[model samples]
Target: DTAVSQTPKYLVTQMGNDKSIKCEQNLGHDTMYWYKQDSKKFLKIMFSYNNKELIINETVPNRFSPKSPDKAHLNLHINSLELGDSAVYFCASSRRGSGNTIYFGEGSWLTVV
Candidate 1:
């Protein structure tokens, strides 16, 4: 089975639309995160969860939200989507604490037109 899985590998939406992406991991990791990769290939962490608790939230727009039901799952919801929101989102997991190898999902590509 895949260590981590994300739903709707591709998403196309119009400005102001609302969307959500779901992710799950079977790697038994304690921490999970959401990362965004822009068109120019710049990667940035948007949010992080440790054992189902919100831990790290970056300076992302208020339109983005991350939810973790358990240590193995993390989901992202976006409201009032904008063209700047277009990017590839990646779900990742790692052991609790810091300095651990993180595993990533294939990525959910979001496009706003």
Candidate 2:
């Protein structure tokens, strides 16, 4: 069984369009995160949730929103997508206070035209 899973592994959309990526973790972790990998492969944390509570929210644009309906599920929604928004979105999970040990999903590749 996959520890972390996300839907729509690849997405191609036009600018100004809205889209969403759904993620789930079956590892029973208390913390989950949304990470973005840019063109240069520089990874940055976008949002984090612990037991369905908002925790770490990075300095991302208001267009990017993360919603966690439960500790095991966290979804990312992007409004008015822009070309610069093209990147790999990774869903990750880790035990609270586990210190750097994180399990990542296969990643959702989004391309904006």
Q: Which structure among the candidates has the greatest lDDT?
A: 2
Q: List the global CA lDDT of all models.
A: 0.94, 0.96
Which residue pairs show backbone clashes in model 1?
A: none
Off by over 4 Å in 1: none
Q: Judge candidate 2 at residue 65 and give its lDDT.
A: 91
TM-score of each: 0.97, 0.97
Encode model 1's per-residue lDDT on 15-90: one tens digit a residue.
Answer: 9999999999999899999999999999899999998898999999989989888888999999999999999999
Clashing pairs in 2: none
Model 1 scores worst on lDDT over the 10 consecutive residues at: 93-102
> Which lDDT value does model 2 have at 43?
92
| Model 2 stretches with alpha carbons more than 4 Å out | 98-100
Instruction: Give candidate 2's whole-model lDDT.
Output: 0.96
- lDDT tens digits, residue span 65-103, model 2: 999999999999999999999999999999988566999
